[model samples]
Target: MKLSIIILAKTDTLSLFQMTLNCIDSFYESEKNIDAEIILIESNKDYEASGFKYPDVVKVIIPSEKFNFHKFLNIGIKAAKGDYIALCNNDLLFKEHWFSEILSLGEDQNDIMSFSPVGKPKINTSNSSFEIGYKVMTHIKGWCIVVKKEIFQKIGLLDETFDFYFADNDYAMTLKSKNIKHALVYRSHVVHLEKQSVDSEVKSKNIPKELLSKYKIPKYLNDNQYSWVFNNEKNLSGFLKFHNKWGSPKLLYRKNKLADILIKGKLGYFNRFFLRLKF
Candidate 1:
C-alpha cells in the first residue's frame, strides 16, 4: 500500500458514529487513484457490538486496552503496510485531491519526514517555529498528519504515556531534536471538527444548541456529554507526563536557541523538582 490512514472510532453516541462514517466516506470519495487502506481502531466495545456496518475496505482492530491516543496510534502504525502513515481523527472531512497533493510534495522533498494538511481555521499566530508550507517546520497540525514510516525508525514510537494530549508536542520536539523536517502542505486540505473528540470547559458555560447543529451534533445529547465528561482526568495526566518528559510547554514553543538547548538537554534536577511541585 502507498498510504495507511489510521482513524480512531470512539462512537459512544449517534452523532459520533455518523461523523466517523462521514470521515470514511469523504476519504473514499476524494482519493480514487491512491493505493491506500483505512485502518479503523475501534476503542468503544459497545459501538463495536452495535452492528453498525463500516465500509467494506476498512480494517477494524479492537484494542484490549482503554482509549489512549498514543497507544491506539502505535497499534495502527504497527499494523500498517504503507510507506506513508496518516494518524487521523474520526472527526475530519478529507478534501478532494488531498492525498495527491501531499504525495506530490513528499516526492519533491526527501528530507521532509512528515506532512500536515491545511485545515479550515488556520493557526492564528506565526512564529519562527510555526508556519505553513513546504519548509522545515516545528509546528504540525496534530489532528491529521501523514508521516513516512522511516520517521518511526529514527525517532522511535510516539510517547504512549500521553493518553489524550501533548503527544504531538512531544513528537514535534523529537523532530526538532533530530533536525528532521516536517511541513504543512497547503495544497492538501482537511476539515477538523475541533472539540468534537472530547469537549470540556474548566469554567463551564452553555454552548448554544444551534452551534451544535452546525457540526451536526444533536442538541438532545445530554448536557454532561457536552463537556468535562470524557478523558479530562486522563488528559490531565497526559499534560503532567509531557512536563515530566519534556519540561514546560512554554519552553517547547519559545523563540530562542536557549529553549531548544534547555529542552534537548533534558530537564535539570531543579526544573524536574519544580515541575513536580507545580503539578
Candidate 2:
C-alpha cells in the first residue's frame, strides 16, 4: 500500500529541521517502493513564504491565526492521497528501515487502525516486541505512527478542542472503542526530540494554560482507566513541573485531580497523590 507521511511543524529551530529532513531522507533511501509524500504544515506565514525545499515534500500553508494541532492534522488528512498515512512529528529522526517495518506490519494485519513502535528510543526499548490488547489503557505518543486511511473515515479527524497534548490519546481511544486493532511495530525505531517543534517562547506561555484550563478528562473514562492514559508517571510529572513553575499551581493541581478522576478512575486518587509527592 502507498504511504503519505505528514510532518507537523512550525518555524522550528535549525537543528530540528535538519534532523527531520535527515530522517525523511533515510526513509526514502531504505523504502524506495513505498509511494511516499511529505506534507509540511507550516504555522508561520513568513516561514512558509521562505519556501523551504525538500525533494518529496508538498508544502501546505497554514495561516498563523492560532495554533490548533487537531485542525492542522485535519487539513493534512484531507490532502493525503495514500492508502496508508503516517503522522510524524517534526522533531523525530527515523531509522532507515522504519517505513519498511511499518509496511510489513500492515501487510500482515489488515484490521489495524494504526501502528507505532512500542517505546521511545533511548528512554526504553525493552518492551519493543510486547503485544498487548489495543484497549489496554496506555499513553500513545504521536511522534511517529502509521494509520490506515479508512480508520480516519470511520472516526473522523482529531478533536480540535484538544489543540495539542491529549489528541493522540483520544484518537487511539476512539479506535479502541470500536475494537479496531493497533499494533506495535517493534522493528521500526524513530527518535523523538519531543517538543522540539514548539517555539520556546510560545510554549512557555501557552501550553501550561491550555493543559490547566482547556484540557479536561472526558466523563466517560473512570478513575483507574483515566490514570492509565493521563496519570502515567511521565505525563503527570511533565505537566506538574511545567505548570507549577510558570502558572498557578493550585489551579493546575485541581485540574490534575479532575484529569485523574476522569481519565484514571478511583486509582487515580493515589496516582495523583503519588505524583504530587514526587514533584
Candidate 3:
C-alpha cells in the first residue's frame, strides 16, 4: 500500500472507535486513487477491530494490559509495510486530501524525518494549497507524526527506554543531531481531540468525561471494556532518563520548552505545570 497508518489505541470505547473509522472512510471516499491501509495496534482485546468494515485495515493485538506509549508505537512501526508510515492516535478526525498533501510533500523534500499533522494550531484552520511546502520544525506532535519507513531504518525505532514520555522529541533530537529535516505541514489537516490518553497531571489534566461527551470528543472506554490511565510515576522517571540521555543543548531545549508552556500558556489546568517542576 502507499500509506500505512499505525493507530495505537490504548483504550478506545467501541462507539469512539467506530466514529474514528467512520471519519477515515468519509475522507477517503474522494481520494480513491491513493491506496492506503490502516494498521491498528490494540494494547489488549478490549474491542474487536474485526467489527469494522475496512478489511484491508489490519489489526495487531499486543497484550500490553497497561499501555506503554513507545512500546506499542514501536510494535506498530515494526509491523508497517508502506512506503510511508503515519503514527496516529485513535481520537483524530482527518481533513480532506490529507494523504495527498503529505505524499506530495515527500516527493519534493526527501530528508524530512517527521511531520506534525497541521494540528490544533493557535488559529484553528486548514488549507489544501501546498503553495509553500513546509516550515523547518523542531518539535513533532507525537499524536500525529508521519515519516518514511526508511527514516526508522536510519535513526532506529523509538527508544523503549522512554517508555511513555518525550520519545517523539528524542527522535526529533536524533534527527536534528544528524542534520536531518522535519517540518510542520501547512496545507494538510487533522483534528486531534487531545482528550484521549491525557487528563494526566503530568501532561494534560484529564478533561472530565462529561465535558468530552458534551463536545462530542470520542471518550474513554468502559472500565470493564478497556481503559487507560497514564502513569505519572513512569512519566517523571522517563523524563529524568530523557534529560540525561539527550543532555545539554538538546535536553536544555526541551527544558526551555517546558518552561515556555508552563510560563506562557494558560492551559487552564493548574496541576500539570512543567515550569513549576523542581527537576
Candidate 4:
C-alpha cells in the first residue's frame, strides 16, 4: 500500500522555512522504493501568491484557517490518495527506512491499526517490544504517526474539540478504549527538533514567565508543543476538555508516570475529581 505523509508548517520565520525544506528532503531520501506522496499543509496566507514553491513531489495545501493542528491534518487527509496516512510535525528529521519499517510492521501485525516513530520516552505498561527492535505502545507522541486510511473511516476524524494540546492524548485514549492497536516502531527513528517555530513566537510575544505560570503548565511542557496553552482563552480551555474526557492526570506529576497510570485506569473514575482538586 502507498503512504501519504501530511506535514504542517507555518513558515513565519527563517528557521521554520529551513526546517520545512529539510523535512521534505529527508522524507524523499527515506521513502526509497515505497510508493508515497508528501502533502505539506502550509499555514501562511497566499503562500503561492507570495511566490513560494516546493519540490514537484510535494502537494501544498494552504488552508483558510492559519493553524489548528487537527484542522490542518483533516484537510490534508481529505486530499490524500494513498492507502496509508502519516500525520507529521514540521520539527522532525526523518531517518532512512522510516516509512518502510512501519510498512513492514503493519504487514506483520494486521491487528495493529496505527503506528508512531520513537523520538520520545516510552510511556505505559502497554508498551512491550514485540519484534526485536520494536514495541507496541498505547501512549503515543503526536509528533509523527502513521495510520491506515480505513482507521479514520472506523473511528472518524481527529476530534476537532482540541485547539492544539491533548489531541494526541485524546487519540491515544480512543484507540486504547476501542482495543485498537497502536505501535511505536523503534527501528524507524526520527530526530525531533522539539523547538523551532513556536519558540520564536513565544519570544516575539515576550510572554512573561510569571504569567505562564498561572496556567500551571509544567515547565518542561511550556515549550512549542504545549505553547498553545497561552494562545488564547479558547485554547486554554482545551486543558480541561481533555481532563473532563479522560481522567485528569497530575499536571505536576513527577514524570509521565501519571499518564501511564491514568491510561491504565488504575486511578479509577473519581481520579480526576480528587486529583484535580489538589492541583
Would you estimate the TM-scores of all the predictions? 0.74, 0.66, 0.67, 0.73
lDDT (10s digit) by residue, model 4, range 94-123: 888877888888888887788888774444
Winner of 1 and 2 under TM-score: 1
Superposed model 2: Cα runs more than 4 Å off: 48-52, 63-65, 118-130, 133-139, 201-279
lDDT tens digits by residue: candidate 2, 160-278? 65566545655654554444567766677777666766655433322343564444533433356444334333354334333433233454455445544544343433433343332
Writing each residue's lDDT as its tens digit, candidate 3 over 52-170 gives 33345555556554677777788888777788888887777777777677787888777565666676543535564332222223246677888888887766777778766667656
RMSD of each: 9.9, 9.8, 11.7, 6.9
Error of 2 at 161 (Å): 1.1
The better-scoring model by lDDT among 1 and 4 is 1
Worst 10 residues of 1 by lDDT: 129-138
Better model by TM-score: candidate 2 vs candidate 4: 4
Per-residue lDDT of candidate 1, residues 1-279 (tens digit): 399999988777788889999999999889988899999998777775676767789998989998788899999999999999999989999999988877887787777778888786355455522232322222487888898998999778887877676778677656665556677876677898885866444223444555444342323324564353223444444555665666554543442244345445653223322322322
Query: TM-score for model 2?
Result: 0.66
Q: Which residue pairs in model 4 clash with each other?
A: none
lDDT (C-alpha, whole model) for all candidates = 0.71, 0.61, 0.61, 0.71
- The clash tally of candidate 3 reads 2
Task: Report the candidate with higher lDDT, 2 versus 4.
Answer: 4
